[model samples]
Target: MTTTAPPEHPPAGSAPGSAAGRLWRAGRAPAAVIGLLVAVSVLLSLGSEQFPSGHLEPGSPEPDGARALVRLLDEDSDLTVARTSEAAVRAVERSGEDTVLVVLLDHRLLPEELDTLAGLGSDTVLVRPSLRSLAAFAPGADMTGRVDDERTLEPGCALPAAASAGDAGVTGELYTAGNGVEALGCYPAADGSGLLQVAAPDGSTTTVLGTGDPLTNRELDSAGNAALALNLLSAEDVVWLRPDVPEEVGSATLWELVPAGVRWSLAPLALTLLLFALWRGRRMGALVPESLPALVRASETTEGRAGLYQSRKARDRAASALRNGFLERSVPKLGLRTDSGPDSVVAAAAARSGEDPQDLWRLLYPSQPDPYTADDEAMLRLADELDRLSGRLR
Candidate 1:
């Protein structure tokens, strides 16, 4: 008669060599690619400066850059116009009293740097300056809010530049000067200030225009943008302080940079990951217990019993089982009858196992038969004794 053999399976560690295995392997590339894409997107969104520079760069031809305005200043007037961001006093001084420093960088400059620029001999014009920038360069000049005016705002103030510029797109951060501060606030929003001008004690002027639309290439032709931009920037000399992106002044951790909502959400994510790991690692089926025949090899039986005992932490039961099995084999080997008393079995086992007779007697015939107390070390010693006794007979 012909018989069929059982199907083979992959070993514990070996990857399966089948159609399913091939599919799994094939899926890995796409999975890795997707994960990498997600990681890159997250990094870009989190760190603002992670992307390339040139937001308002003068040299850049991008829509946001001041290249057109720089070119206009270079070509339109016969005055010296330098398209540079470096804080060089010598360049400004060389242009003499007619030098005008038009700072296009909005929020990049540090407080000290703005202060230094304000103190220069040249007339300064800061376009869309930050609060910190306002504090440093234009003292008493604080941004009020957004412009509420729907139409183009006129230069209502006495400043000649604003007056000549007429109605321009002054529809952004509104400014207000504090009391006793000798400054002219033109292009009046709902409140006092829009285009602020502070005359320094040394006669050098510091002008803070609320919007950059007047100078940008796209908006330069709009309303009186050209007129305003030229009036503000076209002195005998113009120093465009387009500062480089500044380094983070203070060191901060990744956790500190993360938003509060994102940080708070991580706890639930960690818990979900833990649950997923547990679910993935859990055993699929229940264990099936097996009983071996009495005629099984002594070592194999002993190893099987040891595994069971260890799983259940039944040290005492394991020790007793080991001793009983040894006695059953040894009594017959030493010529003692199967139904022999405990003393005789112990004496015979001790002689063969090379252990003390009294010690064997106590271990074999303990106070309790079913339940007894034995630690791991005692169980090990008992198993070793049985092995030695069985070996001697062989």
Candidate 2:
């Protein structure tokens, strides 16, 4: 009678220890690494300063800050203090058509952003813009004069905005408009108008103010400044964009320009590569000690190696090999330990062979540029000396 037991199945392909288990084991280290990285990034972000600081910053309360005017504007209109061009554009879009976009410190914005903002077609106020910014918002208009004296300039134009504001301390850069264009100038100066309003093709009006002083906390209450500032900024929705100076703008960093996700993928990719390397390493089994298929004679092996050394013109190496081989064989025969120091071995060999210690030392332990290493003939001479020395030792 015969009874057979069922074969034992391996744990790899059965039940809960299959695919899910392997995946978990393989991915756990990488997952932990990703988790730590995310935690560190969050902590660093939390510790950083988010608000930008500069002139005309809506939140700042310094003398140059427009926080007071911003608060006043907020009381009458839904005000959005935007730090970037995209944010400003988005806020304006959300607020609908009745929004008034105020752009100050325009030099901080890129040239392209300025062009985009100019196309927004909203009733806008430009406060002390750069030459390029002026061109984008107000074509054919140029800064012509600068008023050095900080004095009140009467609203010389018949425009409603200036007429309502009355006389104001708007003493700063002036501008002039092109001929026949629908334009109005106020705050009279010697060379150009302090305030210039020009008509846009989209039926929106772009009013350029010569100075930012009227909107600052310091001069907000002086003269007709408050009235002028309010008149220019009046709307149901107000978008104030005072962009931050782009970091190291003249020589911006490469990291700042890289697309966001590319920088984040490096860690996971490295872990994946490492896991692949480990898996490959695991598949390699223990090394087997393989015996020579056919035993090689010592003399034949020596001659083959010597032939290679001669072909390569390795005279120094050949000389060294010949001396080391002779010492290894002869030292043990002279009752000296294999690890005996060179000088001790040399002295013992010199005594046994009755040879001069200096001459034996030169022949056995050669330095660089030894006579034997110069040519094949010299190397042969060294081999003859070693053979002679070996015969004496016996």
Candidate 3:
């Protein structure tokens, strides 16, 4: 009987005109768009006041309590107003000559910051609303005011020197800026030259001014407190320091400082793109035509062969095919399985082939069929016999 081969099916990825191919062709546009969007957003944000930059206007007034003090100093004093924060204080101290260190403390001062201010040696002023009475009266004593008095000052008011009477260790004069709205505390140095601590009657200390708002532009115009603010900060070149809150500092540059995990992810992405580029541009071979034969169906051919085998009861033939298949598969594994068969066949073959009988027996009928348990001796003998038999057959 004459038989013809069926048509060849193309490999899954062989069609260069497939959807995957289209995607491969069109992928660059979206990537370019995304890159452009990111670039634009960064540029626009950099142009806005929200994005912090060194070249922009100094002492941009934020809508907070500090703005009052900021405006007051900017409008009234010869001092150049430069906004700063606690973190940048050292830089300001270093660069600023005759700089006024305004601590808008609306609460008690941290020990370290207090120590830092105490050591400044230059003139420093602590301004707020609640602590004015303290600076006006008590110069070095602790606050003797009640907690209710402390609470009476608005959310950003300085603490009173009287309230901190027992706790006052810093040596500075505390002065009041406004009635309950604002205050200032001045702490003088040992020679009575450098301003140290200022307290408000509302029971807030000079440290509180660093936190409260009488110094900000928003409230400096309200209740005639601007004069008081200018008077307090006017002695030196005004540096308007705005310390960034911890959360703001943390979220500030989020995208620029990519972490290690992101960097590793980008590496794999870059490699994948490189591989894709290599695959797309390199021409493999020419496409070949495939034609189907009209004679036979695959299913019919398989069923007919099975029926013929069954009708003939070709057990020996089937076994021979299985043995041949096994031999073909196993022989290449170190030229092994050449001596595989029943013992008599193995012995007859070994003798006829000049191979060891004992070794042939081990290959033909392994005592332990398990690969894990097969002994080294059996493996070695079988390998030697198989090699000899394979050489003879070849």
Candidate 4:
């Protein structure tokens, strides 16, 4: 079919406001929008200081830090606060009963460290003990669950520490004191206990407090928190053990690092992405009729037919058509009848072309032993010989 030629493209730099320039201009809006969004985020982060920093760190001045409590122990009280676990252990070792080893950040401590701290001759206070640390240090005390409320509660049990503190912020993990150990359960939870004081065989006390919130700088002044912290930390020397993240725990598996909620949340996001891909990747527009060349030459059609015949291996059909076409065209030129037999046609062709009659007969028709089988090679040979004889007739 007839087709119009496409319009020629303009030379490079011909038009300053071409499609390329327009495309470049189009990207600026999105880039500026992204930059603005980033700037806004940075400004918001700089403006707000809602969350506390350096959780439970003695040296930190942030609200969440235990700097106030450390200062209280260092200045107001006579107890000298030893910072690291190594220093605390050494101080406890040197002073013996004179030193009080107060364990903070118990979750970071190793089992061996917990054992060492638990077996100390001096009184030890464990703040925010993980289940593993609690089980290792205080055998009978088991964490039940977490407390929803962070409000102060009355000291229900008769432990001297609790009784003296009166109402205290013991709102964290609730625990239960088993019958095997000589332990006092304090700050009674609905189901179990919030605090446990176990008398170790080494003549030293192991106090398990549920949370470290009450001991932090922010909550230290709230509801008998100062009184409770002071009473618990009252000693000649204080060894504050801030346990570092253990090597074994630090090498936790990928699954352990991802929280359950975050893992669950990924499922929906993944499904959404999958659905988006399917939607965007699908075939979009409807089918349109394509224009073809207006005219196909006779020679091209003949070559195309031959190609189709060769591809389909239609040797018999091709041979028959070739022979019929040759005979129909050459019969008039050779002065032979249209109804002439194969022998007559071969004799006429041989006489005109000066070829042997036997060869012409063989080319015209298959012999008794080997009838026309329509093999591709045999068909081609016959067609070529026929063309040579037909040339003689012309």
Best by lDDT: 2
C-alpha lDDT values of all predictions: 0.71, 0.86, 0.45, 0.75
Model 1 agreement with the true structure over 13-80: per-residue lDDT tens digits: 45676666787786676566556655655554555522223645566566666677778787854344
TM-score of each: 0.47, 0.51, 0.35, 0.48
Worst 10 residues of 4 by lDDT: 44-53
> Could you tell me the TM-score of candidate 4?
0.48
- Candidate 4 lDDT over 60-90, as tens digits, reads 7788898888888887444544545666777
Which regions of candidate 4 fall more than 4 Å away from where they truly are?
1-53, 76-84, 245-394
Q: Model 2 over residues 203-245: C-alpha lDDT tens digits?
A: 9988999899999989999999999999888899999998876
In angstroms, how far off is 330's CA in candidate 1?
A: 47
- Highest-TM-score candidate: 2
The order of the candidates by TM-score, greatest first, is: 2, 4, 1, 3
- Candidates 1 and 2 compared: the better one by TM-score is 2
lDDT of 1 at 97: 70
User: What is the descending lDDT order?
Assistant: 2, 4, 1, 3
